[model samples]
Target: MLTQTLPTWLPRLSFAPVNTAPRGDTLVVVFLRGAADVLNMVVPHGEDAYYQLRPSLGIARPDDSKTKKEERTVDLDGFFGLHPNMSPLLEAWQSEQLAIIHACGAPDESRSHFKAMELMERGVDDERGPASGWIGRHLATLNTGNSSPLRAVGMGTRPQRSLSGSVPVSALRSITDFHLGGDLRALQQMRAALETVYAGDILGQETLSIMDTLQKLDVQNYQSPITNYPDTEFGLALKQTAMLIKAEVGLEVSAIDLGGWDTHFAQGSSAGIMPNLMKDLAEGLAAFHADMADHQNQLTTVTMSEFGRRASENGSLGTDHGHGSMMMVSAAMWTAAKSTGSGLGWRKVNSLGQVIWRSQQIIVMCFPRF
Candidate 1:
């Protein structure tokens, strides 16, 4: 029998209405911090202008005999394709669970990373005024009548700005630390003292909710077969995320950010820094996909950066900050596309949803080369 233990707040602790429960669907946001070149990451090989513009940095189309198969984009409906580094996710896209939203942005023109990220996270279209994050709003909308302590969790030391709101969210370094063990009487006493401290103020309410959620995370049982994660900070972070998802604690949202993509220097498209970074990201995400294969239907992962780099490479073999980025939605959303199993080129439709270009539109063709 399945038992759901709803948390009860002590009289001293304050509380707010719990957000709506998940419909069993999960939204994972992969924030690719640092400006990543959307054009290079999502190669527009079929576009002549792409090749013509970045003679040194441009990736070749699928049929380009000079390009190695492993380095080429996996075809997707003959238009936009996945980078060779992202071959792991290709299967997901082929499974029709993945969809790509190109030329879409935060609706803010600010080039500053801080400002752009703020606008995107806050979900404000006009780029003005204080507003909650989209996920926070989504959580608010999802909040059901009764409070479920285990409804939302962010897998880290502190909750991302996107997860902050009136609702209480759990921030965990690991599942092991979320619960208390030992004597029941001692546990109750400790909780009582904590509750006494929390009851009198705004923090009291959040403390109650957070403690309840942690307790829930503590008891959840989960196991995964032997797996290896890279030693990098981002790599470890992703591995932890996989563990939480596998735990099946009713997680509805997970936020992750991977940085060092700001390739203003030595941004090699084919080899060196950029390629290595892409490789790490690809491997991390691939491992995550593999770990959650069984739960694909209930999960959708999305990756995004603030903006793209310049269309051309600089003297230092890197690219500068530019505009118009790309987003990789789970292939699960477009099950039909993944079924076909082919690479694709660029197709340009402006941010406003107008078809500005028909055949493989890369950077120069997609944007005005500003």
Candidate 2:
């Protein structure tokens, strides 16, 4: 029995009551806005076609003979490899906690970022699909009775389309700033007045709950166990997410965005724009995974983009919008006892050059347990 009403004082956002004993894993969805170039991110060193397609942009194959690892790819399975900048994620792969879904994307062929993002976020195959997001629908189906006010959160100025539905979700820029606005004396007066006005109703009760949550989320005093997070916006978002999870405030889902992936010019190889972004992404994710190691059994993180870059590089040394992209999933819910395979029954490519593109539908359908 989740409460769905929005408080008038907090008209900007909404909250939901979480079940005392909810069932299911907490989900973190990372949206790599501005289509990421999967081809170079996950290097295909074995494929000569890949090297030939973008001779300048392609990453160098893994070389044991080379003294400098920065100039080459980090071999994952001989044929396929990771961009050297993303070395932070190597451990996750080795431990089998990370799974890569190559050539995955929405069915729509439109390369427009807005349209593509809308389609993907809505979890619809066509333009006329339902308005509610896949995550919103998923939460609507769950039996989370009157859950925590922080059930689903979008970490930014606005909530992503994925969390749009009947369920109350919060859009947060910073947890530290989540409070009643006013100076010291004004704040005290406002709080006292609000308490008097909401003394004995659901609104008052929920307001008290929110106050308690804010106190619990005293982010200024929290310290992350992992120390390698990049000093970037993405890193900060993930750090806050970890804090919320550790607080056990009934956060069932979170959506974070990392933009600037639309590399259309001078996208360098091993030492350029792409590499820096890749480093930020890899380091942030790796740090989050390490910081939340104790709660890995109940956490699942997934990364997706609107689409992929063109198979071939453009004249500007970057790439244009392309058909197929990739998805990455790191889940503690998938135990060592379960099959390590993607479970989607898609063919696994081991060679660096092999291009596997099929009608895999968008990632919403690929969500675990959906």
Candidate 3:
């Protein structure tokens, strides 16, 4: 049999020069790939305009006695509520661990997913900003000296655009399968040969780091206390992310993508494709929250989309790409006292009635620890 090297697509474990000590909370960024219709996800039942605009696709108010429990939105506040399928997140809300920023999104006027996403990830409004990703730029500020091979990770085949920069990031599909795939004997021999050939060199150091990470992630002992993941790709990704955080392998930042949010057609209100996606997102996030309960203080999860859907329902019973979406921030440390009444310099909308969809800018809520 011909000997084969590791696949080219496999992430290369390398390190960037560190300046300051690694400090700060672990930031887990969840990108809702398709522009999620935040208007529906976080229903603004208080606004008569919302209902009037979204006639067919409008979610019923939380107090709507006529709708089924699974059909009506779960009221978060007097005005805003979550979609019925997103009931799983109510626990976080009630616990004061989650904060929803309504009518938030990038200021870019481009409704194109690619352009908006690129600009958002790059953390720039126009073409004048640096090419590096926001997270990557943030990582550049940290001094991660000789840290674990997995400092920053994107839980997918390709690294998320937000993680693109001077920092070395690993884009992984499956944590379990992240290894030299082939004959065991050949792998062992190649490893030994490489160790000898690059001993005391940077390559050798990175190789040793990879080995150490693999050893730490010994599949058997790293079981999560919370196991009820939805068996979807997003579920698995969150599960693995929790596992990685639990392992404490210097995971400062992790980016996970949950696609299929572009509800251009058949976007039902009470029941349909949107609800199912909400279920997956809620369940997966809830599972992750449960699994990482112990590390709640150290974990902060933020969800964002490129842009939001149009305020008005289209003729196709769906929504078109529009401005002013919402971003969700969940951190066990975010108390009502800390987040309430404090605008953190970001524009605050007291109610859905006050939200100016056209002028709304996506606010990147950075916690104190972040």
How many clashing pairs per prediction, in order? 30, 11, 1
- Model 3 alpha-carbon drift over 4 Å, by segment: 1-24, 201-203, 206-223, 337-356, 362-367
Could you give candidate 3's per-residue lDDT for residues 233-307 as a string of tens digits? 998788778766654456788899998989989998877888889999999998888878878887889999998
Q: RMSD in angstroms, all models? A: 8.4, 7.0, 7.2
lDDT of each: 0.62, 0.75, 0.75
Error of 3 at 360 (Å): 3.4
C-alpha TM-scores of all predictions: 0.73, 0.85, 0.85
Residue lDDT tens for model 1, 1-370: 1234322211122224334334436677778888777777767665666666677777767777888977777766665666677666676666666666666565554568888777777766566656777677777865344244445566677777777776667776665667667699998998888778867765445446655544544323322343445566666666656654543344577787787888878777668777887888777777677667776666777787776665556677777766667777663444364322123233333474322212122221110000
TM-score of model 3 vs. true structure: 0.85
Error of 1 at 96 (Å): 1.2
| Candidate 2 ranges with C-alpha deviation above 4 Å | 1-24, 64-67, 202-207, 216-221, 335-370
- Identify the superior model by lDDT, candidate 1 or candidate 3: 3
After superposition, the stretches of candidate 1 with alpha carbons farther than 4 Å from their true spots are: 1-23, 145-150, 177-231, 331-333, 338-370
